[model samples]
Target: MPLPNILRYLHREQRFLAVFVVGAALVAGFVKLAGEMQEGDTQALDIAILKALRLPEDPSQLIGPSWLHSAATDLTALGGVTVLTLVSILAVAFLLLLGRFRQALFTAIATGGGAMLSTFLKGLFARPRPEVVPHLVEVTSMSFPSGHSLNSAIIYLTIAVMISRSFEDRKSRIFTITVAALLVLAIGCTRVILGVHFPSDVLGGWTLGAAWALGVGLLAATLQRKHKIEEPDGSIADQSSGPAPDQIGS
Candidate 1:
């Protein structure tokens, strides 16, 4: 079967395509808008405000590096990309152990596909890192969309979705969501606190990440509903009244 046909079949029963197309278009439009933005003076004003707010500029100033390193390592271990790798491996391991090939296949596709989309989008944006001030921590990459923040959203949120499958308590769900959110927020904030990313860079990254992840998530939900990949739940629904202050970062 052709690729489009397969994607349609993968999500055949729902409005995945409509949402993906529209979400992707919006992301593209925002990327263009960010690129066209020439508000350096505005950013300068914000930077002055940031200093006035007495926010710590360096990660070490906010938290010591040795301690922050351990924290980053801890989070890194639990971070999205890491979880994706671990899950893929374990899923394969489980498939081998239990002969659950279908379980392995679908989980791999949803998780793996999301990771790939995140990578592709990162490369496409390739925004340079901020040079407004000397970086507080070492970094080297295009900085338009923060890879850590974007990937954290995809990875953390994906793992949380899978974990919610077995848990049934309200507290359990809330905890999982909180942990995932804090991880994303922390990773993004680390970028700015480390002085590697401007506040706007992080904002653009969060916007793109949110739209991308939500689009993928909604697609995943629609597919699960149509394909019956897993047990049904009131999935991928949101109750937010407005854009999350995801940039509650820098």
Candidate 2:
């Protein structure tokens, strides 16, 4: 199958460039946003958004239909510890079954590292959860950066990038990334709507999460380039024409 010319070119010539530009941008954004949050610059915006989700007379009561609240709760769960853990385990198991041990290790490191990073940031910030509106869901963690939003982006986006490398078709790669992005966006929104996090919290999470995920991907790509880790099926190997005949490449 013919890949999009630009996408293929990017994979071959600009992998490092792409990761650097995107990762740097995300890190910069996260820093700027965190500073604003610390200075209380985001207070007005956060309050406005939180209020918008609730009824005018009673901030404790959500504005949406009953079903929406339930749906948001379900979606938010997708980013929770239990759900994400199961996903990581299943993915790693599948990779191992295919004998892609190195890829499996990379997946474990990316997901585990992201979780640790989230916990550390939460402790460092120790920002309180929103009080303007009654929380639709119970939460006890620090709230500057929503853990659900951050972890969801890190896990889903990293998995998407890894899986996309196995496909030679540009459309397939784009679709995978797009889907991951949408899921991250939806989960972040749900946290805000549930009144468990502030807008700036979600923003901070996404910014840092994107940076972390892309950074891991860059490392994996570097290892693949050096033949230190196994490349996914159809990935360019030393710019070879294709995998060795009957090699069943990882």
Candidate 3:
């Protein structure tokens, strides 16, 4: 689909849509810019930024008391597979309670779809990870599509949307989505901060992941509408919300 149509679909709220469109456009620009540049010094700006902000480089140091970093690490870590699986199960369970079997099934399909797209794009771009600084983390996958960034964003954001329709208060609905966004952002940055992914990789991951998630989400919503499924507006995050496919319909 054209970018304009995609933007229209995502534009449920003008302000948020503006941010998303702008972010995607800017990231796309940078991805292009990054593609043109040869191996150059990246550490100078980073060093200056780090010094100006007085942020610590060590994981332990970054995790002083916010506990969010620690949580983010757990979500983004390779060991996070178990967590992701568990979350997916929770999402399905919620769908089951809401009598949304179709969506429960969609969860699996959507995540796989996102992964496939990420792989395809990574191969298409063939972007290399930055070599200016030493890699503090280990990664073997193609670098253009950050797996960690895409997965978490798809999963968390999907849950957020599912819960949004059920809650009348709006705050309850918004909180779940807010946390989901935080998880996506935190995990993406963690990939960069850990020296495992280039900014472009994370950018591409979010763009591609959100696209897949949104497509699936629309499909799910369409199915729900056609079938007249009335799902309970329960808090999705409090339970086992996992992959976004669960959030697709009903």
CA lDDT scores, all candidates in order: 0.57, 0.85, 0.58
Instruction: Report backbone clashes per prediction.
Output: 2, 0, 9
What is the lDDT, from 0 to 100, of the residue 58 in candidate 1?
A: 47
Better of 1 and 2 by TM-score: 2
**lDDT score for residue 29 of model 2:** 96
How close is every model to the real structure, measured as TM-score? 0.60, 0.87, 0.62
Residues 178-198 of candidate 3 have per-residue lDDT tens digits of 877777887787776555666
Candidate 2 scores a C-alpha RMSD against the true structure in Å of 4.7
lDDT tens readout by residue for model 1, 159-249: 5654443345868867976787777787776666556666666666566655655565565454444443443332222326432333111
Worst 10 residues of 1 by lDDT: 241-250
Candidate with the greatest TM-score versus the true structure: 2
Error of 2 at 148 (Å): 0.4
Pick by lDDT: 1 or 3, better one? 3
TM accuracy, model 2: 0.87
Itemize residue pairs with steric clashes in candidate 3: 87-241, 87-242, 88-242, 90-240, 91-240, 91-241, 107-245, 107-246, 166-233
Off by over 4 Å in 2: 1-11, 234-250
**What value does the lDDT take at residue 135 in candidate 2?**
91
